[model samples]
Target: MAHNQLDLLRQRRFLPYFFVQALGAFNDNVFRQAIIGLLGYLAVSPQDKTLYTNLAPAIFILPYFLFSATAGQIAEKLEKSKLIRITTAMEIAIMSMAAVGFVTQNMVVLLIALFATGLQSTLFGPVKYSILPSVLKPEELTGGNGLVEMGTSISILIGMIFGGLIFAVAGAQGPWVAGVAVILLAITGNLVSRAIPRVEAGAPDLRINWNPIPESLAIIRLARKQPAVRNSILGVSWFWFVGTVLTSNLPTYAEVNLGGTPTLYVFALALFSIGTGAGSMLCEKLSARTVEIGLVPLGAFGMSAFMIDLYFARSGAATAAGLTVAGFMQQPGSWRIVMDLVGIGLFAGFFVVPLFALIQSRTPRSELSRVIAGMNIQNSGFIVLAAVLGIALQRYLHWSIPQVFLALAIANVIVAIYIFTIVPEFLMRFLSWVLVRGLYRLKLHGIEKNVPDEGAALIVCNHVSYMDALILAASIPRPVRFVMYYKIFNIPVMSWIFRTAKAIPIAGAKEDPELMRRAFEEIDAALAEGEIVGIFPEGALTKDGEIAPFKSGVERILERRPVPVVPMALRNMWTSMWSRRDGRLRRMRVPRRFRAHVDVAAAEPLDGASVDAQTLEAKVRELRGDAA
Candidate 1:
């Protein structure tokens, strides 16, 4: 039975870590919001309040610039479970100091405490993300990230509400309550951290570098060495940039453009956060539990579309007094504005979850923590850049917050185009995802366990239709190099996709001997490089919806390279649009089937030398059963 993502919360391996991270996030928000609330309602002068409020976010973010590199090294060098416990212990101490600051009502002490908390968060960032891959299965990466993001979003919202409500109702006693709450939360986080199963240090012998500047540069350079990882980091950072701009501008946007009160502002925040939480959960269902970057582009598109809609939804007239949340919702065109905010948040979830999973899945395990630290450094830079740009456009250029949003939407389009063009894999995956998901209902059996996660393996499947390679490619999680007949490989639209996927094209020896020789050479080199090379051993599509005679090519390939061969069978595709059931012309004339049920089954791998083409064909036939 397949367990839902929420079921992970009950398991010991994941639950403890989840609680620790969630409590930490909750504490951070509670303390930060309490401080902001204090400045807003209790400060002596408007000037003083403005100064502190302006400086607060900067103080918290500064540590990322100073300590992220060192933090990354520490996470890589130490066992994650021990490091988390230590970090949580430090959090308890920091919250104790914050409690003192709250009781004393000293701005200096409180600011210092806030800075200390930021440092604690900076140290925890790398471990929080890097440990997921270590603790969860590869198939669970997307679901796990969704759960984490949802938890964080909900924590932030709850903390914000608690901080504001406690301060409002308690008066002078508010800070005391706030202080005690955070302290208790911290202690609880530490207690939970103790239960986390110990994860082995990824790079125990790695030397620590105390110098932040040079080490930061080196870590980024290391991340950039892998193109996909580098692009994913950029995508993740860009999300932060856009998100910061939207969030930081919300209070003023609500006040000036929407004519909304504090309650309305909170309502707007809730919409965005809830939308993000919903979208994060939706990722597992949309991507079919795989880490699909195709959704990233889809997310980017929705983000820009709704952001533009939000810009247009802005009312030009300003009000001296803001409307209450209830009053604002009742106004004409207000629901559209709210929906736009929700849409942006929803798509933001789709954009970020997959990118994070991609980074975790692609980076070398030993360096994953450091790479995440590098990403944090870049994220901080982008956030700072966002603040600067937002200020310049609104203050210096005399642009309204709505105009800034418009500019941001445009910026998202440019960034998406640039990244997709540079890394065509993202676009290729999007096309493949659309083809498989839109056209067919796919079912898989034993593909995840039977196909080796790492090392060279030749995948041999019985071909039933022209879309066979695509169906197989989309069904399996890993990238595959398909060796298909040259005619089908060069099909007008799909040829580009095959080329982008780096599929190997070949012809029969009688037709093109050179191509056949080159194909064998390419297969040998691909297998040597520990890649998954897929081939249809029957050599061509079945004309009468039946398996063809096995060919000697499989035996020849095995003679050169003795690797495990995974046998896969595709069923229910023989009657599909791409199949040559009636004739090529007639099949093309027939309307394509939508959501046709297709089953793909893979038997356990067999040793290359022991399994002949005939035996492998029989196994595939058995897996297919009576299905044509």
Candidate 2:
């Protein structure tokens, strides 16, 4: 259990895998960019260069479409570390051919090798993501994913630079340099793969499907088994789509809009890539080491904001041509453009990492490899569509680069809204996160130790403030179906959040027996379905800054369900902004202890059949101590 993501890099479990994937990404980009550099080395016509540039991506992506299903099956059937070694070995063979293509300056050889590289990548894709869940705990998923994304992004940027520079820097020796570099990278990745510890097969007893089409469709169905997982896959594919459009337009965008040479295109890309890496690194800290999908909405809108700003920052051609990156920076509005590029990249990171973690954590381990495979296939489709759509917008519609960007920004908003609407959990979590983080600095004690990671359990916490549910929801890694009073459940805008979170609304027997019965039924059903149900037991927000007597509802539920009961206490929340200490229930008041230090403490699970309300209340009191 490494507390920090970087700490994983210091350990054998993660470092080897990280470098293996990073090296693969580096070599992949290096090989592709080297082919582009070859256009100059071979002195091809501009038309030929354009044709090669357009054809390379399609050639590379074709294998993902063709072999992802078979690849997924192979990944599931073999042990993870062994599969990785095999992929790295495949990479060495593929890169060896690519080296010949470079040395002989043969375009056809390079294209065939490029397709081989894609096939190798397609095979690696499932194991690349699926292995993470096996090696990392649920708490470590976000950080681990962040590190992977960071490594891949930075590696891609550096590889692009290194690959593109071989001809420019080495002059007559460019071919040899390109040839040697890719092979060495492949060898390095292979060496790193050897160090990744042995991991059990995702489905060791499973038989692989040799026919790709049926298996591909079957995996796609598997990927869509759960709505959240399905949408997560869609979200990842959408990320690729956005990235494809953005990256494809950068060359022209740089030359036409910024009036810069080829160097500026790389510079702009560097800014975006660096920003993405930085954002990826931040996910662990922002998410509190949880697979927090709340960041997805934050990332989504943040990307759109910067993209829209980018369009406004530069909507027309540059005043001059052939300006260097330095000269381009000297121009007015350049810094804004720089910030926009970085911002879009930063938010894009925020958007994608959580979704990946969600897909990994939520999907069952046995099927995860194939799920990842299905996602890769869909991602390839989205990338191809994005390239084609972007090209169509430019060539057929004659849209300027800025206009294309503007359309992308608008499209992003629509897509985001649609996804969030269909899967309100992403948005629900986002709103809860924002409300909790905005109001308090939370400290958790015994939560990881006491709370069950899976299966049904009743979470009994003290009713301290209006924000208690949000705080607890944000603090706990798993989703909890909070049981609240009908009034609070219908609290204007707060009602929507509660309903979306699937919080059960109850009333006192005297107030409405029907609602109370319905609430009990829902709670029983939820627990029966292996879901966490949270209840205050005191049945209302505490009017005084003291714990109230526990009600009999807890006893009744446990009597019926006989599930484990987790006693949790919200400490120091009595004095917080949303508490009733202001002499009213959620009254508007002047700031007092804003961003207050609030503690959520939990005790080990009590046997539901044995524990009484008074015992649970006393346990919660001990956890809370005198903090209230």
Candidate 3:
């Protein structure tokens, strides 16, 4: 539907939903920050302030652990747009109670309302992520999720700034200002939610389990059912952990390390938030509008790089005390610190956005809501653990903020390695992503439109070079089990990547009949499972940059399984380094077409039942045109 990520902002389907979610996040932060402001206004004892501040997060997060399972079922059973409206409507009631607490200066009432706010958020959680897949096409998931994350990041930051300043500017009128502001924001969210177009329930006829404990376990099991999805959920929780640790330390870090006033703490947070927002928005462009999980590894390493630098940038106390934001910026190594914070946030965005998109795209639609619910439960645990561990490391172990950061950076690398090791797809994708992007400036034509988004399909493409499979895989949004030549599949370093990608290795029938039969069996199994299978119907790389006669293997495979066949072409790859144009020894020579412009085009799918190998080859030839 939407060609660009920004274009979605102009459409009613996404725009209204985006604003509603952003408004809800804005109001949530405003309410919480206003409570802090209220405490300051009353000039409560530091002990009391510490008590409330510490207690608030636990209370807010508890509802996620308690009610998220039920919420997930409800989300699956109701129309998505209706569920959103109901959540926004609930927000109005919850924020109204918060308003009363603000005006009455009742801490008990405020805390009760805070719990209610968390309950509302818990209920909204599943539908928040689940609705995107319903409204957006597969190709739009990354961009759409990017916008949502960006909006949330910016909204929370701005809401904190606005809510925190209400007390400073309004002083005696602070309570009234906060009360009115929260209620108005809630109402606005509700009003905007009305414009979100109706989307059908993910599992309308499904029965709900009212029990939280068992349902929570069941949903978590469901989330972990797929290895990629499971690892992705873990990655998302890790992001939250890193975020909590990094953000929670900023106040102390600003004061102790930078020798800056309280205002500098906010300034530091603003930089991280802005960088995160920028990174979130950039996911679409970086991913080429696909659900590119390859960015996850890049993001993780980038985050670690910045965080480690932050420790070395200034590992000790400030040279001066009580400097303002401007004065801190004027100090030596200050710009490096600023760059580190922004870089950390920026990479954090790159890390999380693709994982969300992957979860949505890969999970079955009927179970997506509950899966998201399960992820929320795990995320809550991670946030709590990060908070506790951060405090313990600093308070009990006597680790400085910089030391904690350094530890976190190291821990991040460990976690990343563990996840990648368990599910090498993330790492495989990353490697292929780098190989393709580094070698060529690739462009796609009719891929999103012509390739099947779901269901088993056969893709027949002319084999131009050894890198064709990776290039095609990178260009296409969905995973394709390429039927690569067995030798290429067994190549020294590339073998591991191919095996990890689950590429089917085939031998020529004359060369090895048994292996060829086994390859066909695997191909059939993959197609039957509703997975895409790709074949170089030409059977080998073109020797003279011309299409070889299509082999009968495609027809034989199609006869056994009549799935749709998509004709695809890789252009300008024949002259690439891996192509047969250069002899073996000459292949080692320096590449001349580095970062060459390459095109991958897909024609509309042809019915496998009727199309023979020759017709498919003609179609691919047409798609390839004169590019080779």
Q: Point out where model 1 deviates above 4 Å.
A: 318-321, 584-586, 589-593
How far out, in Å, is residue 420 in model 2?
A: 1.3
User: Would you list the C-alpha lDDT of every candidate in the order shown?
Assistant: 0.88, 0.92, 0.93
Candidate 2: tens digits of C-alpha lDDT, residues 513-628: 99999999999999999999999999998888788999999999999999999999998887776778878444746447678889999899999999999999999999999999
* Candidates 2 and 3, the one with greater TM-score: 3
lDDT of candidate 1 over 111-175, digit per residue (tens): 99889988999999999999999988766788899989988988888888777777888888888
Clashes of each: 0, 0, 0
Better of 1 and 2 by lDDT: 2
Please give, for residues 218-315, the per-residue lDDT of candidate 3 as tens digits.
99999999999999999999999999999999999999999999899999999999889899899988887888888999999999999999999999
- How well does model 3 score by local distance difference test? 0.93
Q: List residue ranges in candidate 3 displaced over 4 A.
A: 584-589
* Superposition error at 271 for model 1 (Å): 0.9
